[model samples]
Target: MDAHPDPSAPAKPSPDPLAVIRSRGYLRILLLAGLIGVPVSIAAYGFLALVDWLQEYLFTELPGVLGFADVPLWWPFPLLALSGLLVGLCIQRLPGTSGHPPSEGFKAGGFPQPRELPGVVLAALATLALGAVLGPEAPLIALGGGLGALAIRLIKKDSPPSAVAVVASAGSFAAVSTLLGSPLLGAFLLMEASGLAGAMLGVGLLPGLLASGIGSLVFVGLDSWTGLGTFSLALPDLPSFSTPTAAMFLWALGIGFACPLLAWGIRALARIVRPYVHAHRLLVTPVLGLAIAGLAVLFAQVTGENTGEVLFSGQSALPSLINDGASWPLGAVGLLILCKALAYGLSLSAFRGGPVFPAMFVGAALGIAASHLPGMALVPAVGVGIGAMCVSMLRLPLTSVLLATVLLSSDAYAVMPLVIVAVVVAHVITGRLPEPPGRRLSGALPSASPSTV
Candidate 1:
């Protein structure tokens, strides 16, 4: 922190806020965020780890009274019903934890109050533990933001709006930096997702990104030393890609055509499910969850094989989905695609989680389906489908492209070109495609719904 030129200080009237941050008190904000965010992030890690421990302990024990017994699908029904009831009661009772997911996007302006942290953590933990179709990013972000805001309250009594926002943003960035494997990925995600385009983007975003990058490194180093599974978005052997043939280009066109229809369908189901959840929140939510669980069970029992296709988060499933899985029948793969999409949609409607993983899964399934049709290589098809569908759903081409390229190994080199083509095609197609008849308009996760991550 060297003395920076203050554009306004020359006038003897004001100090440039940006320069003030860069110089002045010497980016005490970063120091403040670190002091608070380190503990908050570690706490976030601990909270998730605790949830894992409990699930292993409680969701697996022998069936018995008050033991939270390992209930069959049917049993989770009543138990989940009770859990939903409790959750609903808690939500209604505690609006703090039930506020909203960070996937709703950061405001880039306001800061969360100190009181909001606990509810954010608990709600996310409980919702995730109950096998929601979402990820932990929301809770982690919310906790980080809250902690940073709390620190700002203590350190700089007169911290301006911009200062407070940076702290919160930095905290969030730090919290999930390593979760996604790269700080650049997180930075790009926040930059695009926050809609922080303009002169101000770099001023506010760079510091936050630096914090997240450091935090990600810290998480990686700690996890390596501690041997605790740090949930990271990486696969060592993602498929290799061939050049984009004319057939692959046609596939992109096809995905572009179908992306909106699929996106609309998912949105429609979530909206339909939302009302029922609202009506009998306590009962319907768990019942629907149990129904989803039952579908998972039936898929397993009927298929005589466990694909875990409809299980919790889909982030870790990408590598396996791309690997030696070409053996699945086209019909079966297609059906799984449809079932998982519906499950994901319904899960999105009621459950508290992010839609990114489920959307990615749907894209992968669509790709697998397309590749299985005939001569198309499985790897390229998957990449194209991922880009096309993800862009359509999230309405962001860059993020989808990163997802497509970064999720691969050697293939990303080849995959990058095709992914861009697919994303452009899908973005156009989705925009042109009419909303379903009598269908509601669906925005992206945070923009449209409160629940989605």
Candidate 2:
């Protein structure tokens, strides 16, 4: 046969990957996704549990046991310093460099290599448990994806790469679905972040959706069985927000304008500090941690609020912040915003964890502060702030809007219009803003593009 023989022959069209949906192998893939969801969800639950317990013991209970009537102002300094040392060591010594850098912004895909799981686990534990201003969702996603990919390799040594990617995404979906308080929210997040859309979006996300649905049951079952609740995000008992006013729309536009500037500052600070972190992981990391601790201490001293409010990811504190916003002095709320933003930026530079909750927290703080202004209600202001800030940072408008509205389910519909406006505005502004100089972490994948995966 001549090498050029095919040039003269009629060209055959390539097989459609979507056609797999009609094949029996697709059933196997779905079954595998469901099966993998079980283990991944269990592991995710356990990881969250450990992190929660450690956070309580270290930040809350340990202070009482140490004979301090209240947590001392200096508590986080040493703890965060230790966290930096451990995280630095993990990055320098471990195989995977401890997962992706948060400074790169939120990434949707890129399953971690199995060998890197330990570094991801240990670094995230140190970052989260010891009061770094980041969330656990990123680690959960990476760990789940890695585990799912590993499982497929063992189950079918000859599995195609496409099937492995689908299953890996399924595992990620199962891992964070309930944590966001809904499988659909997780689906939206990954879908938007992964840039899935059109018919291809359905094809790519089907397996993940099934995995997350099954995984939600696991989360609920475990919560009921063990009396340890699913660590889901939610906001309850807000004052009623029934209608959107002209003033509310105005505030949404203003917030949409403001959030991008704040988001830009945070990322700029992280990028400026990141080069130093890379140059001296051991020394600079802990110094940055100490600086974060100093900011928390300053906020506590000024506001008479607990240092914990500024120390960790803002998940546990977010509800209380909003519910009690009216009771807070405007000056205190402003101080909190300043302190948390600084601490969050510092964490992003050198720590290893997700950026979602801290950004949400900052947004909520801004909203609560803004509500003190004329014509701004607590619920709608909070929704607008959350949507704007989230989109500004995450650059996923759909996920940001859902997060803002869904968490406030009682007022979801009422706030949807404003949230949509804020999300779109922030998304556009963030896109037009210049990005910081790029600095990829050692052994980390390149940052994700906005284009389709």
Candidate 3:
């Protein structure tokens, strides 16, 4: 009886310790990807630096030389609209290159084919120079990712899916590293965007993070060696902090509540313009471009400020918006926010660029508006506004905080608490925002699919 095995107690099978990963082919692909990523990251970093120079010296300076009352409000509008058209055409016409960063959202891995890089570069530079509501950082990631994937394909006859993802991540890390002003932000962006889980997190994340670290180093080295300067959304003269006050915390709380409203406004405008952009694709796009130009003219005329206030890049204007204006009336501040927010929403929908800078501009404007209220300091208010807006737009809490801190030179410590409070408030407020009507799932309507990449 004892020798007879019970029917329910048969011999147990041994577990293969390596069974989890050994069966999957992704590990080999990941290794190959890391091997190819190092140089690609370096190249991407170098390219961004060059583009940075062009944005400042070429785009900013060109109009001054042309001299149409400082190139007039209409100048960049047409050039940028044409750029959006080209980018749209490129996305529609090019196989494996059908989308850019803005359309793609925050998905982790991306690599555009080499053929698409030229279009990506031209569109991004043109869009930026033309004063589109978009940001350059988004395009930079696409360019980097696409070029990196292209490199992998060339070097290897066939690459594993894992390797492709790793390279793309590395390329992205490099491309936007300088814009973040810290490789850590780049890494955080990737990590938060990836949606990776469990063991898969370690598979290629390390290599991708390594690439970003090296890329930032390369960016710093080149900036030092060439004295070309590292490109950042920062003003060198941003005054240092005194100690943060309780009022600054209140500013964060207020910014937190206000951020959702701004976010909704931006998205709503984008939705409104998207159909128009799509319907008129080739013909109507240019008209929309002219409209933006008209709006710019109106913005300058109504506000009685330089057309530059409402025009291209807006990077230079960020610090000014944050810096308190004793002469700026409350009415002017409100008008600035409304105009910039509207322009930002329209520009985001029809134009090609990133959302980061526009968000900063919005926040800065909001800060200016709030500063007019009693008991608010300019720097802390600006920091709260920027951080809150970023949280709403990107939904990246850590990234928003870093962005806030990096901008303040002396008062970073004081600003830190406010940034945290603002980010948390912004994040919570963002959740309260209702998803767009078209975004809801229903059998009767079009599918709103969720994507991992």
Candidate 4:
């Protein structure tokens, strides 16, 4: 036997996942991520634009054109039914089951395959544009990741899986970089969802960070060029709040305790409804839409508020709800919470969008209602409520805390302590709660990724 190893032999790959950070191939991936961010961001912007236009034309313009003084109480019934029909078709007939079900809660597991993008997009459009109570994040993530992986495959069909995954993640990072109003917030969300930490986390996140930075520029540029606002989350002109009181901490604990129970009930209803919806999607989906519409209509009738308050993802309406918090009656706010939660649960069971905004809306509503309490100022109460509810629903304590504070930028420093306390309490409570019986459907895609690569 030859004592010397052959120079011609291929070397074994290093077991250390972080080794990729030092390789020339990783540099190539970084470059590709940068390049991909442009197209991915543009695509994401276009998708949001289309969703916005469709929503306006169908819900607002079309209603006016049809001679309605305002959108009639029954307006959403047929529109949502149509949405359900389209979404059902996409989920049943197309690939990828119309992306992950919102009922499964937020996650960052696998990206949709390129072939699955059409179904995901169509389903999300139908769900969101037609007034489903879900947001746009999940579909955006799927689109970005799918496009990224597809681009890489087209360039080098034989690319290794690790490289493909990294590029795909970068694509997702770009897609949602501006959706949450900050690239860092989006990064934090994906990072927590990604289950990466320490050295591996750095290696996994750098390409995505680069891509997200570029994506934000593209998003801003597109908004300027097209005169279409970036669909980023923002809550401007919030009432000033500084100094956390002793009473506020007690309020935080109470709100935190309450939020988990509310979240649990919402999720429990969705999970129970999901199996039945999947079993009879064609029939059940449209019915769920009608039910959601009924909830919105009922809320409108009771509160004399616009049905929009309870109909969609609540991203747009949230600011108005908070900015004009004093104008809303306590009874109306409470009713809004009840109706929106039902609509949200129904949407989660059968729709194809995101869970974040609706959850936030509910949290905001809860906070607004709680603001009526003595010794609880509106701003701190809202901050605590939002953080608690978000953590309860998302199980992402850090992201939930940041999300609450980021929206209240001026008051973030004062609110941070309360937000943290609420989030921690909610997260702990949520952890202790047992999973609902048969929470996951058969053949459901797992939501957590074991490896970032």
Top candidate on lDDT is 2
TM-score of each: 0.84, 0.94, 0.81, 0.94
Worst 10 residues of 1 by lDDT: 444-453
Model 1, range 45-141, lDDT digits (tens) per residue? 6766765664444444534545644455444344434445555655555544354532222222233456555555566666666555666665666
Query: Which one wins by lDDT: 2 or 4?
Result: 2
Residue 218, candidate 2: C-alpha displacement in angstroms = 0.7
Clashes of each: 3, 0, 8, 0
What ranges in model 2 sit over 4 Å off? 1-18, 437-453
After best superposition, candidate 1 residue 18: deviation in angstroms? 7.1
Candidate number that wins on lDDT, 1 or 3: 3
Clash pairs of candidate 1? 97-119, 104-446, 354-453
For candidate 1, give the lDDT. Answer: 0.65
User: Candidate 3 — which residues are off by over 4 angstroms?
Assistant: 1-70, 96-98, 101-106, 197-203, 324-327, 437-453
TM-score quality measure for candidate 1: 0.84
For 1-453, candidate 3 gives per-residue lDDT tens digits of 599778998679744435634655545544544554456556665665655666565446777877644545556565656766775665455443333435223355555556656656666666676556677776677776776677777777587655666777777776666666677776777677666556566655665666666666766777778786666556556655677777767767988998978887777767666665665666655656666666667767777776556655566677666654425887777777777777777776656667777888888778767766677777787788888988888787887888877767677788889889989988998988886432311132112212112
lDDT (Cα atoms) of all candidates against the true structure: 0.65, 0.88, 0.66, 0.88
Q: lDDT value for candidate 3?
A: 0.66
Model 2 weakest 10-residue run by lDDT: 444-453
